[model samples]
Target: MSTAAIDVRGLRKSFKDVAVLGGVDLRVESGSVFALLGSNGAGKTTLVRILSTLLRADAGTATVAGRDVDRDASGVRAAISLTGQFAAVDGRLSGRENLVLIARLRHLRSPGAVADELLERFSLTEAGSRRADTYSGGMRRRLDIAMSLIGDPRVVFLDEPTTGLDPEARQEVWRAITRLAADGTTVLLTTQYLEEAEHLADRIAILHEGRILVEGTLADLRSLLPPAHTEYVVRQPSLEEVFLALTQKDTAS
Candidate 1:
């Protein structure tokens, strides 16, 4: 049986009468990739924030890595890392410097060795000595994620980690994400790119109107659609096509 790295029950959050997360419930199994799918303002980031201990929930409970997010906030923080939409790298510092800085702040011994290890792990060793400003979007994002792993946090929350990057750069980030999962790190990724969820997630949950409309493995979710028959050519629709169809059906009903 797989243990849940992150769990939530009846989570609710609101701002001035606006419900951002209205009774959200979710679970992410340890060492698996769980993707959260939603459009803009669907409260994916809000949920990630709540789970990561960055923002408090108005109601309900969440536990990360066996620690209660509210009652054991520090413990939750210690067991998880968050990579937001933007790459949080300083242009003035070299890639190695950034990693070393984070490792040092985390109070880990041999910060230089820690930085060097991550640099090689993320395939940034060749660029480690270069200033972050010189690195491409993908390289910078990889460095940011590598820095996040200085303490080997069990759960990682990535909120649109590949946004604004070109296709090639996106692939680079995708490889990094794959490596994270291969190393047995639980990832809860929020992405608007349906193809991204299709490629990386072990299970996916669709968030609509601040609630989970559906949750299942890709094949399981695909079962929600009726089988198609073609007379001339049999074509398989992509995840984007299926997602749009479902969401439109939901909205139209």
Candidate 2:
């Protein structure tokens, strides 16, 4: 198997007269969390769709989880799962039921066992039996994520999973992503939330105009910007300053 979790070279995509992605290239290390950050309409969603095998690039060579995405499309599908901006659970079914259905859809050998494990893994055990329609957005998203893991995929693609969520719900989703990474799952995350990327990404790549503008560890990225741009004023510092200090400390330590 290839060592890189995701590999893309000269990836390009176009729709009608406009180019959505232009010669984009990315390499994500195995078992690490990589975040793609860009503003609205920056081709983040287009890139995610291509990597997850939901869409084909107009021109590029890409491989995901050791399989050539274009030639080995089935292999890519088998090795990865995708969670979009919206939850994908059946509202009429309870959370547990939704998970079970997903397991079955994936043709897992033991759907019940997979559902049970996912429920526990996602901390939805107590709420597993509640109808998905009755659950909070966070709970629904948890179930959506849990369902994605039904086949125990090696790579997961989350495309703005916390978008449009309340603060508390967004935090819950963040925790879920943290736990998934802790368990050594390779994650390719695309989000417009700068703080979220700073908090969870092992490495971050900033995409603009469908191309990478900067890519590195958080500290390395900060270095690209002006110094004192991230001032560390402990007492009476603005929240932004405090955030910078804390993030720098966390990165440094």
Candidate 3:
């Protein structure tokens, strides 16, 4: 059995005349949170969809949780769960009901027990009986994530989990994601929020122009560019100066 949560090499994809992904390679260790950072339309979603078996790559090999994405799609789907940019719950259904439905879909025999556990775990116990449409944004997001955990997925793909959330709500979701990874679940997170990646990722991979511009730990990546530091003269030190120095920016700091 392979311990790697995900492995991809020479991954290439194209949408008609445009190349979306060009020779991408990634290797995520078991139980680690790997953040793939990129701007809009940078193929981050495409990569996540392909790994979660929602989209197929035009070329190259990929595997997830020891199952080949191309040859063993079922196995990959069985081992992975996807929480998209938007909540996928049925708004007409109650929180607990949504979880039960997904549990059933994943063929869980003890769907009731699973639903209760997740409801409590995600702090949705009070709202579990409420219709998803009536729930707040945070509550709905929690339900969406809880639904994905119905079958104890080994790997999860989170694409912009906090896209439409306020600061507090985003922090709540971040904590939930941390808890998931701490419990030995491998997470492939793609987000435009650099601070979010810095907070949660064990390693970061930046994608630009359909290729990985860089990949490394936060500290390591910072070191790669330069060793410039800033000593703020003002009593209230600004990170802007430090950032500019580190990034080798000549914007007159």
Candidate 4:
């Protein structure tokens, strides 16, 4: 098996003459979190789609989970899972049902057991029977991710997983993502949130103009930019500070 969970070189794609990914290269280590940071239309989604086998690159080679993305597409598909921007849960079905449905589709022997296991793992056992429509944004996102893991894929692609989520909900999802890497699942995440990348990624690549502008740890990337200057200000004391000083003086007296 390849040491890298994902490997790409000279990747290129275009849509009717408008180039999306132009000679991009990336490497994601096994069991690590790699964040691709880009603004909307910067080709992050396009790159992910290509890696996940949903789309093919016009040029370049990609190997995902040790299988060539083009030559061994099926192998790539079998070893990876993807969750897109929006939660892909069925609103009418309960959380448990949604997982069971995915398990069945994946040809698991006992779909019900698989569903229960995932619910417990995601901390959704208490709400497993509730309709997905009733789930909070965080819960639904959790369920969506759980469904993606039905096959226990080696690599998981999360494209803007926290989009539209509240701050608390986003934090909840972040914890779940962190747990995935700790459990030895290689996560390739695409997001526009700079803080999200900094918080979750072991390494990050900034994609701009269909190319990688920089790739490294947070500190490494920061070092490439001009140094920041800090300004110290001295200001008049507040009323609280003045009162504290008078109280101390009286106590000493």
In terms of lDDT, which candidate is strongest?
4
Question: Which 10-residue window in model 2 sums to the lowest lDDT?
Answer: 228-237
Regions of model 1 farther than 4 Å from truth: 231-253
**Taking the tens digit of each residue's C-alpha lDDT, what string does model 1 give over 23-68?**
9989899999999999999999999999988899999999999999
Which TM-score value belongs to model 2? 0.89
Pairs that collide in candidate 4 are: none
Listed in order, each prediction's TM-score against the native is 0.91, 0.89, 0.89, 0.90
Which lDDT values do the candidates have, in the order given?
Answer: 0.95, 0.91, 0.91, 0.95
Per-model clash counts, in order, read 0, 0, 0, 0
Give the least accurate 10-residue stretch of model 3, judged by summed lDDT. 244-253
Rank all candidate structures by their TM-score, best first, as comma-separated numbers.
Answer: 1, 4, 3, 2
Model 4 residue 159 CA deviation in Å: 0.6
lDDT of 1 at 136: 93
Model 2's alpha-carbon lDDT is 0.91
Model 3 TM-score relative to the real fold? 0.89
Q: What RMSD, rounded to one decimal, does every model reach? A: 9.4, 7.2, 7.8, 4.8
In model 2, where do residues sit more than 4 Å from their true spots? 229-253
* Candidate ordering by lDDT (highest first): 4, 1, 2, 3
- lDDT against true structure, model 4: 0.95
**Shift in Å, residue 118, candidate 4:** 1.1
lDDT of 4 by residue, 169-243 (tens): 999899999889899999999999999999999999999989999999999999998999998999999999999
lDDT for each residue of candidate 3 in 93-187, tens digit (9 for 90 to 100)? 99999999988987889898899999998989998898999988878888898888878889999999999899888988998999898899999
